[model samples]
Target: MSLLTALEDGVAVLTLNRPEVHNAFDDALIAALTRAYESAIADPAVRAILLAANGASFCSGGDLNWMRRMAGYSHDENLADAEKLGRLMQIIDTAPKPTLARVHGSAFAGAIGLIACSDIAVAVPEAEFAVTEVRIGLIPAVISPYLVRAMGVRQARRYFLTAERFSAEAARTLGLIHEVVPAADLDTAIARHLKALKAASPAALKATKALVAAVDQPLSEAVIADTARRIADQRASADGREGLSAFLEKRKPNWGQA
Candidate 1:
């Protein structure tokens, strides 16, 4: 299996199993990831997702063999291939459940997109990152939207063009990663985040993720009115009513009890 999945305590841990290639993605791996994500989203028991890998490197981007095969393909064939990868990124980015990237070692080229698409990313201090496609005569086109949103266009422009390896500290400053900890503490850090996620109402968490994506778009009158309606709807929801009543009664919310 290119990917390993386990569900425990409301968290679905998706582990990249191809240590031989530093967990680099190929067509098979991409397909496996898409299925894993869909399965997790469809599982009611899963409250959060932890994306991890089994080797020293988090992910080194595209598999070398996959690239070699792409080199001889016609333009249309290549476009089709790229679309599959883009679809995988889109599914994870817009997933209703909270997603976290547990990054270590190096995350390069397309791998950076996975981290950027996640709601939160935690990396070891010694981890390295790069947008290295430019160095190899290709562009990070598919991952551009998520990268730009995570790192801002100014920073994305420099890294995407330069293809230089950056430290985790720099990545944190650029908003690519949320926290940088020692390697030994990576699992603990992820656990902390998962605990917090599990405590929140699942419906509210999904709504919040949607809200962020919506707010990022141009704020027109329609957008404003839509947001107002969403909040009003939430306030009148069963979970919302229970949350308010629980607070007033000095008791844990029903969702938290689970």
Candidate 2:
């Protein structure tokens, strides 16, 4: 299997299993990932997700073998192929559940997109990152939106043009990754994040994600009205009421008890 999945204690871990290729993506892997994500999203038991890999490198972007096949495709064929990748990124980015990336070694090209789509990313101090599409005479077109959002336009301009490799610390400083820790502490860091995520009401977490995405858009009068309506709706929700009641009673929320 190119992808591995496990659900435990409300956390679903999706592990890239193609270590021989440094977890490089191909059509099969892409399809598998889409399915895995869909399954996790549909399963109410899953409260959080961890995107991880089994290899020296997290993901090397595209598989060389797959690229060779794409080289022979016509323009239309390539466009269709690119669309599949875009859809995969969209699925990860729009997932309602809290998503985290367990990044180690190196994450390049499309792999960077996966990290960017994640709500939080944790990397080891020795990890490396790059937007390397330019070196092969190709552009990082598909992943550009999420990459720019995560790193900002200014940083994207420099790295996208240079395709230069950078350290994990540089990635964190640029806002692409949330935390950098020693290799030995990677799991500990991820666990901490999972613990925090699991403590929140699942419904509220989903609404919160949507809230942020909506706020990031141009704030027109209609958008402002919609935001106000959403908060009001949440305030009347069962989970919301229980949360407030729990706080006043000096007890843990129902969601946290699980």
TM-score of every candidate: 0.83, 0.84
lDDT of 1 by residue, 106-225 (tens): 899889999988899999999999998644445677777778878888999999899999999999999999999998998899999998998999999999988987888722434333
Clash count, candidate 1: 0
**Candidate 2 regions off by >4 Å?**
218-258
Listed per candidate, the RMSD to the true structure in angstroms reads 18.3, 18.1
Q: Where's the lowest-lDDT run of ten residues in candidate 2? A: 218-227
lDDT of 2 by residue, 1-258 (tens): 899999989999999999998999998899999899989999999999899999898998888677666655555556667767777887888899999999998799999999998999999999999998655545677677788888899999999999999999999999989999999899999999999999999999999999998888722434333433443343344554455455445676674221
For residue 135, model 1's alpha carbon misses the true position, in angstroms, by: 1.0
Which stretches of model 1 miss by more than 4 angstroms?
Answer: 218-258
